[model samples]
Target chain A: MDEKQFRDYLSSYTDAEKALSAPMRDTIRINTLKIPKKEFMGVSGLKMEPTFYENGFYADAGPGVRLGATWEYFLGYMHTQTLSSMAPALVLNPGERDIVLDAAASPGSKTSHMSMLMNNKGAILANDVNWERGSALFSNIARLGVLNAKVTVRDATRLGINAYFTKALVDAPCSSLSQPYAYKKFTPNLSYEISKTQIKMLFSSYDALAEGGELVYSTCTYEKGENEEAIKLLLEKRGSASLQPLGVEFPHEPGLSEYGKEFRKVARVYPQHFSSEGFFIAKLKKGSA
Target chain B: MSHVTTFREYLQRQFGAEVPKEIVLNEQEGVIRAYSKTLMMLKPSGYMGFVAGKVSTRGIEVKSEFAQLLRNPSRNVLALDEAQAKAFVESESVAIAEQGEGLRIAKFGRHVLGVGILKAGSLHPDFIGKGRKRVENSINP
Candidate 1:
């Protein structure tokens, strides 16, 4: 999808066009497990504002200071992540005692976040299919002082685990349409193929979830085929799962209701509207057998 | 494997730090690793594939990747000031004010950057590893 083509598809062409070229804000989330938020904020030369999430902040990175290179980051006291990417973990809200599964965790931004949320108390099965990325996941997990997580190299759709998890996070792989340069490579066939894999991953995630468990499915794409349609297919195939409303307060539009009433309960974030990257998130609950 | 006792004895002789009872050390392909007992459960389920650290021929050396998991360090510690810490993290050796040392933890403020070595009254930051360059650049800048 070219800029013109994408603009024509948007609800407001002018705002969307402007947002596509807008500068992305630098945001960081304080790792409370490592350092207190107040003390980290006291570091000199940092000017920031509270993000939608309490632990996150939108900061003006000083000249020549790479946020990733800071001492605080080295200590794993903070993580450089986009505000939109931080939502899925916030929504999942894993507890200290819950056994959780990060079905497609790699490079471990969300997995580490879940670890902090869990206070490194329970077990987290962090899996990624790619070996190279799995190494990065392990490194990040270790750097962040995350002990409860176990790194695994396996396709999430075929994870042969005998035990069920109380909660799961599926930030499924999707077409990178939300990225500024992604539209150049966008194709109908590619989108269709990704949607199919996404649907399969969703089913697998639901299968691994224990009864009364909650799963948060999210993606960084604006394509309905890969977002709502995939969830609709999962609901149709799995009789034991249902979609639930997300009660968290964040800037977002309702998911396309044309798909279904339950789909409307899902949240859609557009870069133009939220001043962040495009994203879709839906909360799911596995009913008792 | 066969070197488990040797490795334990090495740690005791060199650093005077006891290998904790809860830490299970396993050797694979000539590399020894230390892991918590809980990791055993994940190993049986095939959920964990990576080891925490490696024990070298010299002594039980912790891999940089798992350095954060080391709750206790050998008494040899050198605290660096902001300037010295930045210089040390840039992979540059910096002069230390307080004398004597061997393997020391390089700390900047409250954050532990990793391990460093002190020889000839100068601290070598090679232990910061390749991954920690980002921290050096950001904090030092």
Candidate 2:
């Protein structure tokens, strides 16, 4: 809120930790499914670097070019996303025809990434509580050339669909405290007391997941209440789901706070610490439904 | 792709505005589909799913929001009567309406479709499917 309050809230994090809060330059990944990478390079005058463990490319452009208005973007060859943000969907490791759930998916960046990872073979249910965002989600799905997903506008808690998913991404909305680093208008104070809703949303999302399914609980906030605490609460409620250690060379060191004794296995990411946004990703496997 | 190219050419010949270069076209069955965003821009990829098929001369299948634009092309000026609305929908004539924000056109389609444009001068995104039936049903029912 104010400068002193912002510093007090950020007091727990060191200067290096505070640096991770800055947002990286806007980057987009070029999808090769519809159009080749070369065509995208030619049209946008942007070069590409290989993505982390995916076929998509990392571009050196910003969103100002109206990339979406171009015929190339409309053709589904390119998608605007961040480098670090794309990790959760790839980590889910969904198989063909496996149903998936993207809880709190809006302005869908990760949900579409998951579909491309699945090669658009199976069904993905992208649910968001906000009705205003429902159509925008649909518009993105259609534009990306993804055929396997279905859109549903319902509160995250009322997601009583009969289908069971092999994987789910609960990218719950957090305090968005990490946004300040990415954009000037955002600050650490943004997430304070704002994560309570996200905790409730994540709890409802876990209820919709299935046995033997993998769930990647993620948030972009630096707060313990929304991150590990929420996962800890859900694990306690659903007793069958357990935290699985992440093996990937994640960009940050672990969080000092533990949601539960079992969540010691949880993996935490900080933007200043990880060269990306302040993110927390905890992988949970449903041993029983 | 063939059908999409053909359809694009036809639309360009009919309507002077050459469909922007980056909008991708997909053809499946007899319909032609156009999209404004890319696969990656789609966050929740399955959120809205995919288009049912291609756009046909009979009628194009669009989302409800897009359909609203096709039904009432006039931005804020509600036509005097159904006849005016019908004329707007039946003819692709662009009637400029200075509404709340700025100037936008009211476009008419084959069926009694009308749509309001914001500052962008582009059709609303979800203008597809049985927009006429929905608009009329909203009035009658």
- The number of the candidate with the highest DockQ is 1
Error of 1 at B4 (Å): 8.1
lDDT of prediction 1: 0.73
TM-scores of the candidates are 0.86, 0.64
Candidate 2 lDDT: 0.56
Per-residue lDDT of candidate 1, residues B1-141 (tens digit): 567677666555544556556556667556665544544544324334234444665655544444444455565555678778777766778887767866666666555666666777887764422353644334422
Global lDDT of each candidate: 0.73, 0.56
Model 2 B-chain TM: 0.38
Cα TM-score of candidate 2: 0.64
Candidate 2 C-alpha error for residue A98, in Å:
1.3
Residue by residue across A150-173, what tens digits does model 2's lDDT show?
Answer: 666777755664336667888887
Q: Is the docking of candidate 2 incorrect, acceptable, medium or high quality?
A: incorrect
Q: List the residue pairs that clash in candidate 1.
A: A69-B134, A69-B135
Best by TM-score: 1
